[model samples]
Target: MERGFRLILAASLMLMLLDLCRGSTIGVCYGRNADDLPTPDKAAQLVQQHNIKYVRIYDSNIQVFKAFANTGIELMIGIPNSDLLPFAQFQSNADSWLKNNILPYYPSTKITYITVGAEATEVNSTSLVVPAMQNVFTALRKAGLHKKIKVSTTHSLGVLSRSFPPSAGAFNSSFASFLKPLLIFLAENKSPFMVDIYPYYAFRDSPNNVSLDYALFESSSEVIDPNTGLLYTNMFDAQIDALYFALAALNFRTIKIMVTETGWPSKGSPKETAATPDNAQTYNTNLIRHVINDTGTPAKPGEELDVYIFSLFNENRKPGLDSERNWGLFYPDKTSVYNLDFSGRGSVDVITGANITNTNGTTWCIASSNASDRVLQSALDWACGPGNVDCSPIQPSQPCYEPDTLVSHASYAFNSFYQQNGASDVACSFGGLGVRVDKNPSYDKCLYMTTGSNKTLSTNATAIPTTSHSLAGKVHTSKSSWTFMISFLLFLAIDSIRGW
Candidate 1:
């Protein structure tokens, strides 16, 4: 009886630890590349107001650090890429950096991780990355704060030579020399391997091949990686699994993966039409829901993931494609680019511009006019297959089948899925394959379902139903704690009985 009690106690403790692990926090990246932005103090206030507990900044600015002090916010600070070579060449430089930058306001501001440099592997002096990290770690140890702060660096998905199958992910041959030692250091020190992943880039580079629905994480169709037989519902999971396979190949599967940056832009150039406000809101809002649900990637199910959205505010001076400058959740004026609740309490309608509160009672979803045949066909298969969109009306002998074209049939199916999914932007976006409209596509004898056409359609819509992928449920943490306490009491009772 005593042994059984002890076993239950140990199991309960393990459950508690796992519960803590799965309750990871969602954070935002605080970038400062623009001239017309609020002061650091105000920015801190903004985050606090939004109830964002975790934040990542590119550099250890004094003003920003001071603002975060006593705010109960956890921060991950950075060292610029330009300083990597200098820090690597001399330990004294690193010591001075820690003394000046960190030792001043550490516990007050809660500095949890020190990112050595932002995407240092991309710079010409990539070889300096590991040495700089080592020096930084040594400095932290010398200051007696090594346990409080972890040292690491971030990488871009560009470092991977191949990421399609995910299982076949391999680092670019050129970066192997630096990555080998770096991975070893990370494993020894128990630091997470941070990477920036953007599904938008994949779609932008290959729109014809990549499904927009998959990129947006709204697809019912799953991408099965033939190599690993792992089913991927969205590009984000595929990207993470790609990194996981890469690490496993290198024999460093133990190190955790954290996303230092990932976000969709709200505005873009002419060709980048997918970068719209509705799309951005949909992506970010859905991402929060996915994280809060504690649903890890297909490769690492049930494990918690730590992620930081690309930026806090959009910067006007940033260089590169227009999308590069527009990856911020909030504009420079400190106003949100769209209605997004970081706390995971906002409605999906607020995000998709559906204005669920005041509907006109006449709306339907349809295939976008610009949707290509290939994209349409992919969405059609998903709707008819996994999405379970009714297709009897679009069959050969049915009234809606008179058109018989892929577009006509697909439009009907897309509308059915969209209407069934609540007519939100997320539902209509079959990866840019579908759109919502007010006019009913129903013709004589075709009878397309709309708000006015059928009460059954409205009832079946499920009124902003939570995502199919939602992992939200009771964590059952307290159950284990209580069980441990009860088991201990039973052990005491058994001892008393023996004495009697």
Candidate 2:
């Protein structure tokens, strides 16, 4: 009996460890800025159908709060800039707001976070941010709900005066007065520093320098941060690392960073060639996979970072460029803008590759940007040796050797093997370290071999086609990917760059 009991305890402990390794559910922001959106109840139902457990609304809409009641969905309510002054001057106002907007819907609605203001530092409402946050916290504490719901605010990436090289990221000197007190309050309260990170904006503003693949999380080329010697494959990780460095500079290293907004627009004005349904689908799908994989940024490896995708439905009335109103994953009628699985619990799906315009006979397979060096090396060894692929092209004297990093070399060899073996998923995936692309990976003098025939590649073992919006007969067999994977593989935690 004693031995049996001990075995049961050990099994339970193992299960707990597995649970910790699971990927976190992805969250979405619900901004009701459009006139044609579905009703609150309909939106809540749509969220539930998508298996999304987290949602954030821009304001404390009573209808939205009531809609989420008993839905088991975790919510984050926003306090707009308009309420900042009132909440800052009088804690009583905050108390009243919470009483009317929060307390009544408490446990049933699952309010997990309350954002005091959005883009406070960049907007004119900078002065009231800290005071407003403090007042809200005080009100929550008085009502005995402070411990239940976290109080925080979101800032735009514009808060950083210097973001290049990531390690040099720092808040603007002009905003120092506002940030110093805000950081202190956040540190004391154990609230996360929320920031809106948009790589699309960066790419659109300066397409000459930023690699489109890097911004879209589809790049095999690694951007090494010179100061930290850390490898960054995607702009999202680079952006977060910049914020991490900025926080460390402020002596607030322990304050966790949460992504309040990060997404790609499906439509944009003429100049914004990068924004399209294909690009949006690619960026967001890869993002979901990255999050579920549990791979933290290069700065903070193995850490679970909470993230919320920009908006739920496209807001037709939003101002700015065309892309501004097209960030939503869903249309106004509750239909998905593109095929996406937030839980990341599906087969390995590959959207548009390097070129979305023309994908026919040619296909290129390369190393997954998300995989670690150790994993890439293991796969690289197999691809060069027993995989029966030509790797001499990646040697020191060869052209592909210029940017000769582990990631670059491995990608070349992996593609060689993939092209040689029919470009099938099984041929490319050297222990899950390969990704098949439809575009050429060759550049300059380094020529990657590609499949010339127009033979249709078998999709039997690859991802299922998920473009359809009608879910009348579809079935889900696997567990939620968010609840199973450990971390993303893009940002590997190099031993040398661990503490920097």
| Model 2: lDDT to the true structure | 0.75
Candidate 1, position 46, lDDT? 87
TM-score of every candidate relative to the true structure: 0.69, 0.70
432 in model 2: Cα distance from truth in Å?
25
Over all chains combined, what TM-score does candidate 2 have?
Answer: 0.70
Deviation (Å) of 153 in candidate 2:
0.3
Model 2 root mean square deviation, Cα atoms? 14.7
Model 2 clashing residue pairs (backbone) = 23-482, 293-487, 293-488, 294-486, 294-487, 294-488, 295-487, 295-488, 370-489, 370-490
Residue lDDT tens for model 2, 441-461: 656656565543243333322
Off by over 4 Å in 2: 1-23, 345-500
